[model samples]
Target: MGPTVTLLISIGLCLDWAVRAQQDPLPRPTLWAIPSPVVSKGADVILRCQGHLGSHRFQLWKDGELRDERNTSWQQAEFMLRNVDDWRYAVNYSCRSGQGPLWSELSEPLALVVTGAFPKPHISSSHYYSAITPGTTVTIWCYISPQGPSHHYSFALLEAKSLEPLQRQSPTGTPAAFSFPSVRAEDTGSYSCVYYRKTAPHMASWPSQTLELTVSGFLPRPTLWAQPGLVMTPGANITFWCSRPKMSSLGEVIFTLWKAGTQEPLQQQISAHLWTSFLLPPVRPENTGSYSCTYMVQTASARGSEHSEALELVVPGSLPKPSLSALPGLVVEPGMHVILQCRQPPKTFLNSLTFTLLKVGTPQPLQSQSPAGTSADFPLLSMRAQDAGNYSCVYHERMAPHQVSDASEVLEIWVTDALPKPSLIAWPGPDVASGANMTLLCQGPSWSTRFILHKEGSMDTPQDVSQFSLTHVTPKDSGNYSCRYQPGTNGSLWTQPSDPLKITVRASVPSNTLLITLSCVSFLLVCLLLLAIFCHRSICIAGALHRDNLKRFFCCPCLPQGVCLPHHAEAPRDEALYTEVAKERPSEPSVSNSKDPEGVTYAHLNLRTLNKRQADPKETPIEPTVYATVSLD
Candidate 1:
């Protein structure tokens, strides 16, 4: 038992502890308040730390700040925090286990947001807008308690309906403002915000109250017209027209007409145009009310709206009756003017009145309000047949309970301006091709019973039909043409002369020039057709022959010169020669000469022979015959 043995035991103990710690890895501990996290003032609470591993030491932490550390090998540890309810709020708790010195990863954070430690945040706005215009920038404010620690928590702005976060902010202080630019309809909804611990982003306080946002572009006020004029008698039908500016690209506008003191609208309509008419049949005193209207244009991504000022409908009982008369004689000719005068009973305060003149079968009336007059006249300029109808007038006081007078008796008038000038037009335009059929159409109003078509020079006798047709129009038929119409066979009543219409017939092209052009085109087409046919035949012939047969028949004259010349496929054969020459020289010469620039050799043979050695003077006998000429220079 010396010092060496003692040191060996110490090393063995350290190794054993390290091995056990690695096997278990120091389990993470959980902390919980003894009397629940929500408590009153001056209350004492115990933070009980528990874990699976029997650790030797436990450390307590509040809001990521270490509180206390105790050494004990136990399954549970409790640290008492007294008088926490006095000043502490929005506190977070966590714990970690330790084996001797090494510590485990921190446990999940617990948010102990005290019951009354902090005040709730409130959502506020300065102007409190009911409707906002698109593309306008807006800001919203969220105010919280002023006593919270800076950077202790972060803020999250969320949409309340969907619970989706729109923005997040790091806590610097209380009362944070969020800005939205180019606001659109999609931004319209309920909004709320919450503050969560910075260390534990998930643990958050209660959400603040929600605020609403709306997007609306400025829309012009709608125009309201009460047909038969706002002052109508009972049992008479009237229609209201609410029209606004026309916008082709906007969504369908929904028009709502509401009467005062009514919860629901009296009428609703959806249309794409700027105008909508609401008809109220058989008007009664009960239908009288101060009516106001508004329009809504809603789309998938945005919304727009406009509202009209209110108007009061006056349905009056028995009262004074007015008289109506035409200024000029009846039967007003076309282009002539006339006036209808309505004379109401003279009153001391005539300016406090509104006068309306209406015609039978018409929806609306001509309304006029004079500041100091008892008579109102409606002028009819350039009178026409449509303007000829029964007419009447009425008046109403401007005070509430709007006292209206009885309508005057009907006055009949006639507008002789029937059958407006007929329009003369030519088919296929005013210019016509030679020998082509042409038509002249005389267009007049439906009331016109008869139409007459005339040429400029033949106005005395005109065609009696509405249209004049020429099967074959020649140059002679081309002239100024016009037309007019009569009113229902009343020949005395006729429309003014129509604007002059001229018809021009063009001459035909020369037949010889046309024939030459056709001939040239035909010639070119024939050449192209021949070339195509030759090419097709050559391709068929070429493809029919095999590679081995190409050499001999390649010069096959049937092939086009273009194919054989460019490819050089038909030329001389490499195996044959055109000429041959041969020459024999004696190796042994009969005589030898010197090797010089110019030399010569001589050869001789016996002149006579018999058998192998016989010789005759006339015949030479030799193994071979040879002749040579010698020269030296």
Candidate 2:
């Protein structure tokens, strides 16, 4: 055969072998020590390897080199390691199974430890304190005094709970120190150390005494607050602030927001500052409940602070708003009982409803009530100034799926002493004549927007205004009047009563008769005075003139030249004088001598002396004159 054919034959055989190996794959075995892995000096131990039932041969390898081989028809094989007196007997040993030319995978390695060759070492932590805070650096040392002179030594740190070594190191001298940069709560446990020689007789010493470690208590509690307040509408977002006092350590802290009755947190955050914030999703009606927060130092430990004070969140549900009203009036004096009635709208179908009263700044409900009717009455007995505030109410079903209604319009309660006193006064005067118009002007504080005027004893309705006008006032209208005022139109408290003012109405008199009497008296006095003056003057003139000359002087020019004063002539002894003047015209015939004439004039004068004698020359004489007319035509 040529070389090409030989090579072809070899490739075919390899392919056949590969297919057979895949069809009959070997199983890996488990290895274990019959006695404990740690044996004292001069003790014997049996290392056992377990594999498939059909194993033909078992090979034991120590430290990656073949040590012994045994042919076995059973599923397991055991090898005896006798008199383990030196550290060289302590090494990694493994086994593999083989049938004919094929061998199985190697079993897991088993460690054989030799002890009691020397005294136990000493293990201790670097910290002098019993408990250590998380994130603090820690160190554990394993010390073994050397006998005679120092030799090459290696050490292993082991936890009491686990069989395997946690860490291994070669030390240049005694007392191997293992440094942990940062320790946590999970690092708290019992630990020990072992030392072994690094040369051919790698003998391990006995384990040192177990050292116990502990992590300290949790950090200080944090404070929590909400932004935009605790009460809010649905679909609004809110943020919670979790803060701690400025820490001396510059370590990261975790903030967690938690809801009540739940174990898991709603949100969590990590920040380096003294405070952190948590923004929540848009709220709904179901989100209205209590919440809290806590913080933990960001480390591998589970320790954290106590929860902060709980905060309540409110999200009012969708329902028709109720109406709120105060009985008697919105403005009332202190100590007066006021009823705030919250009423549902007409045709409300809900039954068994609960009504809650809420204030502006307070987070929780001030009071709650359940009523059978459509309205709930909250009676404020003995109201005080502290009870005054903006208030609202809401209603909800008492049963499952508790449906809540929207908040009612805010109603403010004013509790104070009645307003200030308002002054009341009559415009013209307190007294008025019958049938006279009178006005009562009422004045109050400058801030007062309303005033009320009332009568002392009358059934009339009180007037609500700044003033009252009363026309044609009668006795009935005359009464004591007072006034009160309110600060503003926003249902402010009413003021105390002002000082009362009395109104008087008097009867009037008739004026016509008095006017007539006065006129008559004045006319008579003027006539008497004029008569005395004329008579005195006439008498003075007569004393100086003759009787004939007096008649001529007094006669009318229209009379005849031969006419004489025969009708009235001389003066009487009592100093009374009379004179007559005829009325005749030149164009008419004379009728002076007739018994009845058309017209005649008469003059009478009377003069009186002071002592019935001649008057003094030094004083002027009084004139006495009187005139009268007589006519027959």
Scored by lDDT, the top model is: 2
RMSD of each: 30.2, 39.1
Please identify model 2 stretches exceeding 4 Å from their true place: 1-221, 233-237, 246-250, 261-264, 280-286, 322-356, 360-386, 395-403, 418-482, 485-633
The true-versus-predicted C-alpha distance at residue 27 of model 2, in Å, is: 92
Model 2, range 338-374, lDDT digits (tens) per residue? Answer: 8889998788878987777778888666667779888
Off by over 4 Å in 1: 1-217, 220-292, 295-305, 308-316, 347-351, 418-633
TM-score, cand. 1: 0.28
TM-scores for every predicted model: 0.28, 0.33
